[model samples]
Target: MEEKKSNGLAIASLVLGILSIVIFIFLSFIGLSWIGLILGIVGIVLSVMAKKKNPTGMATAGLVLSIIGTVLCAMALIACIACVGALGQTAETTRDILTTIY
Candidate 1:
């Protein structure tokens, strides 16, 4: 039987997964939500590739973390968008009020 050799893809997946978590944390603290989104996507791709090459517990963990990162990033994105929209509405309302008063 031929033995399969482990490749760097697995390592890459692990590194990317860790990076995704770090990026998520940084974004959460600093309000740079887009960085988390990008890192999560990259982590997910690396994890999937690693799993395809060789199934391992690390790869599985990477996959789970990648999914969580992606979801959190997406939620942040939605919240940011909603906040901006609300701000715009509020600004317009304030403008209307000022014009009416003037």
Candidate 2:
């Protein structure tokens, strides 16, 4: 009887996908979205590799989760950058106003 070998890549992909989602949820606001985004990208690559190596439900799930995480992280990162830019403009405007008033 031949035994099926475990897919380590699939397992890693799943774990990384899950971690990416969790990190994005907890730290996205603090500009940690890049970390989650990187993790999600890596998970996506691993999942694709795993799928190519051995088709499995785990790999599919990992791909889905990684995609979701990557999207969320990207959105969060954009929002943070927008917010920073807005604040900077506001500060500069305030400084100008104060200088004119003085």
Candidate 3:
């Protein structure tokens, strides 16, 4: 009989990947994408380590999901920054216009 070993790292990676995506989707608007980005990065690391230890389907899935989540979080963060910049520019313009009118 052959014995099987459980891969806890792979499982943890998969769970973290899923959580990262979910968190990004649900809370990204309020500047919470950083949390997702961090989780995704950790998941990627764990998945890589798990793959080295036992190359399994779960590890591969975790890697893919983590990459996707990380990308999404990065995009969200960039968009948020751009929006804030635009808003600041607009506010300055509005203030200048009001001052000139006054």
Candidate 4:
């Protein structure tokens, strides 16, 4: 009889990594970017752990995707925060007029 090994963690990591990218792109506009960022971080950790246990192409790809997703989500979050912070700062007259007109 042959023994079978499970790749559950690697699979989960891949799933979460892909979801992180998808969510970061589609749901970030609605303030769900944090969720994606969290997912990416979790995926990265899982993928790393999975690699240590049983390195696989899926695990490697998962780690890469998770990193990309994390970066994108972090950038979005930072940009949103900066925009909000800037809202409290003084605005030029022309820019303010344009903003108010919208």
Q: Which candidate has the top score in lDDT? A: 3
Work out the TM-score per prediction: 0.62, 0.70, 0.70, 0.70
Q: Model 2 lDDT vs. the true structure?
A: 0.81
Candidate 1 backbone collisions, by pair: none
Predicted structure 3: lDDT: 0.83
lDDT tens digits by residue: candidate 3, 1-102: 111232788888898899889989999988899999999999999889888878899989998999889889988886432244544567677677668755
> Could you tell me the C-alpha RMSD of candidate 3 in Å?
7.8
lDDT of 2 by residue, 1-102 (tens): 111332777788788888889989999877799999999999999889888878899889988998888988888876432344544567676677668755
lDDT for residue 56 in candidate 3, whole number 0-100: 90
lDDT of 4 at 10: 77
Ranking by lDDT: 3, 4, 2, 1
**What C-alpha lDDT values do all the predictions have?**
0.69, 0.81, 0.83, 0.81
Q: What's the TM for model 4?
A: 0.70
**Lowest lDDT 10-residue stretch of candidate 1:** 1-10
